[model samples]
Target: MTSTLDDALKRLEMAVGLLEASVSRRLEAENRRGDLETELQLMQDDRARLAVELDSALTRLHRFEAATDDVSRRVRQAIGAVQSVLVQAGQLEPEEG
Candidate 1:
């Protein structure tokens, strides 16, 4: 009877140790999951910010391209007018090449 009681007590102690170790492992996993979630949120925020900045830069580039095209058209018109005037004054000959 005494030997049986000692065996029971030892089994109980082993069970308690196993339970504690399991709980410790679960807590560590939870902490790691929380850290991963925080990092994911920060990455998402950075991606959103970068997307907005890229869109703004593209908008500015488009505006610059439009302005350059307009300037080029106006310059072409001015050059044509000058060439016509020079031809009328007999100061420039029409190119044969």
Candidate 2:
């Protein structure tokens, strides 16, 4: 009878130990899940901010392109005028093409 009781006690202790270990693992998993959720939120916020920045940069790029086109047109006109003046003064020949 004593041997049976000892065996039962040992089994009970082992079961309790296993239960504790399982609980610990579950808690750890929950903590990790919380951390992951926080990280995901941060990533989402960063993505939103980056998207806004990208849009602003694109808008600035378009504006710069328009300004560049305007400057290019003005430069071409000035070059043509200079060429005409040179041709009329007989300092340069008119282009054939």
- Measured by lDDT, the strongest candidate is 2
Candidate 1 structure quality by residue, lDDT tens digits, 3-71: 999999999999999999999999999999999999999999999999999999999999999999999
Deviation (Å) of 24 in candidate 1: 1.5
| Leading candidate by TM-score | 2
Candidate 2 residue pairs that clash: none
Q: What TM-score, over all chains together, does every model reach?
A: 0.81, 0.86
lDDT of 2 by residue, 1-93 (tens): 999999999999999999999999999999999999999999999999999999999999999999999999999999999999999999999
Candidate 2 Cα misplacement greater than 4 A, ranges = none
Error of 2 at 62 (Å): 0.8
Question: What's the lDDT for all of these models?
Answer: 0.97, 1.00
Runs in model 1 deviating more than 4 A are 95-97
